[model samples]
Target: MNKPVLDINDFPSKTQLITLSFQHMFAMFGSTILVPQLVGLSPAIALLTSGIATIIFLFITQFKVPAYLGSSFAFITPILIATNFGENPGNAMIGAMAVGITYSLVSLVIWKAGYKWLMRLLPPIVVGPVIMVIGLALSGTAVDMAMNVNDEYSFLHFTAALVTLFAAIVFTVYFKNILSAMPILLGLIIGYIYSAIIGIIDFTAVKEAKWFAMPDFLLPGIHYEFNITSSILLAMVPIVLVTISEHIGHQLVLGKVVNRNYIKDPGLHRSIFADGLGTFVSALLGGPPKTTYGENIGVLAITRVYSVYVIFGAAVLAILFAFFGKAMALIQTIPTAVLGGISILLFGIIASSGLRMLVENKIDFGKNRNLVISSVILVIGIGGAALRFSETFAIEGMALAAIVGVILNLILPGREIVQDEDEIN
Candidate 1:
């Protein structure tokens, strides 16, 4: 294992702390803001609440786990569906609150009964295809944004998207260290520049924006009416299974990185409770759902800095950034085409990650049950199968697929086959 420059409890000088914290902030900024932008929430609110969420998470975990919380990509499609493509984000917020509550409940269960049951419930066969559906389901949106301008096909926009995608791929594949971890931000920067060169970016928002102002926070009962229903719960709460799985995976990897058994020390229940609290607060204040950021984890791996204080400092920085109205405006000015270009790569990576999960787990496609589980999940999820209770409500797409996958996994035989094969090997 590589030696860390700053150990988890090591405190650096003020200047060092500030700089390192800023680095962490920069690492998470791109994806953090991108989620809300895609789902039609305020990027400023995303930044602000993510900062708040991180602080809450750190505090809840006793600042022992050096993990940064940011916007969750897993909830992108769910958020959009709940909000009606940003038409009613308050509904999405309610759904997010439900997700947070679901997390808390799950944490309670884990605390009392242990997490082995969860693993049994959502095996790789169920989780992998659901993750794939998350990315694949958004493929059309990515393509549409990459190729269209104002709903019309544009050659120049397509060129810009291609350039952005190419840059991201190059950075991800060829670069080492921190640069490799920042492919999304680098691709966005390059794409933004290209869009500017093509005279597609509008700078009026940036110009007219104040230097310091409050982020546009959409609060329930203040900005939009708060409403909750079975539809909202059904739409959002089920995705918690995926995100919780993701959270556990992150904790395991982070434990390895920091040379600490975080799951045993801070405990999985504590980390998950913090995550739920973060998501709950973020949603209460109109930000995207918060999850442990992979980018910051990559940063930790590269920089070998594991200080929770550094993570704390970064959270502060993100909050301060949210108040920088001009910067927020600048982020808003980023063209849809540029975002589209990056989303093509970003979303594809998401889909590929699911496949990687299946491969890494050595999910036996040879098994009839395994094959059936994956097949049903992918087709139902990506094919947009829905269980409609009413015109206004339905469990469709990813949520529907996840529920179906879990049920199939539970009922299907051959669960012991993989375990038996592993034992024999």
Candidate 2:
């Protein structure tokens, strides 16, 4: 591993801290706000809760892991399904609380029983296809936003979307260092400019917004009634399986970047519990589910700064920015076509990430069992297969796919080949 400019425990000068923190905040800003925007939650709330969650996460891990928490893309479809396209977000919050509790319970199990069994239960074959399903499932939504204006096809809107998508792709593929890490932000900016020039953007919201004001906080039982339905819970809970797997993968890669075994020093259970707690707190206050952001990780890898203090500073900055009413308003003014254009790349990257996971792990598709698991998960999840217990309750789409994948992984008969191969290796 390359030597870090600043080690994990080393704090930079106060001036340096502010600068680095802002940089870190900027790195995570685009992706962090995108989730809530996509899911019909408050961008301000997402920023605020993410900052608080990062503080909580750092404290829980003894301030050892230099990770910044942000909104998770994995929950986009689930949040939409649970909330009835954001009309009943309170139900989604209830489901998010359940997800948090589930994480806590699973953490306790890992603390007691070790995480090896958990790994076995969710190997690459199970995880990879489920992730693919998540991205593929949202492809239609992305296309709609790119091509349509209020459900009607508009040539101008489609052109704007294409421009945004093209910019994001260029940044992602051609740039290096910080710019390369922020394809989403760059794409949005370019798209916003194009939209504004085309007279598609309405700046009325930004103009009328206060410079400083409280973000619209959607408190459960206050803004919306706490209506917990079985269908919402079912829609949301199974997603934990994929997110947990994603968390573990991030920890492993982060350990490599910082040259510290985070799983051992801070402990996987602690980090995971922090993640769950962050999501819980974020949801309790009407933000989307929080996760460790890869964008910030990219920042760390590029900058070679491993200081947790920097991460903390970034968290603080995010919190402050959340109260900036004009900034929040500006984010809201972003055109749907622009978002759709960016989503084209973002969603495709998600699906590609899943396939990359399979390739990286060298999953043997030549084997019948392996092929069966992947095929079943992809079809069930992307095909919108559901196991409905009642009108009000059903495990459908990605959730159903994940549950079925795990079961199939366990009961399938080709375990001996892997075990024998393991022994040989």
Residue-level error in angstroms, candidate 1, position 341: 0.6
- Give one digit per residue, the lDDT tens place, for model 1 in 1-425: 98899999999899999999999998999899999889999999999999999999999999899999999999998888888788888999999998888889998998998777777887888899999999999999999989998889999989999999999999999999788988898999999998899999889988999999899888889998887888888888889879998898798888888888877677888999999999999999999899998999999999999999999999999999999999999999988888899999999988998999999998889999999999999999899899998987789889999999999999987784333211311
Residue 54 lDDT in candidate 1: 97
Model 2: residues >4 Å from true position, as ranges? 416-425
The alpha-carbon deviation from the true structure for residue 135 of candidate 1, after best TM-score superposition, in angstroms, is 0.6
Report the lDDT of model 1 for residue 183: 89
Q: In model 1, how large is the Cα lDDT of residue 291?
A: 96
Model 2, C-alpha of 122: deviation from truth (Å) = 0.5
List TM-scores for all candidates, in order: 0.97, 0.97
Clashing pairs in model 2, backbone N/Cα/C closer than 3 A: none
User: Candidate 2, residue 372: CA error in Å?
Assistant: 0.9
Instruction: List the global CA lDDT of all models.
Output: 0.90, 0.90
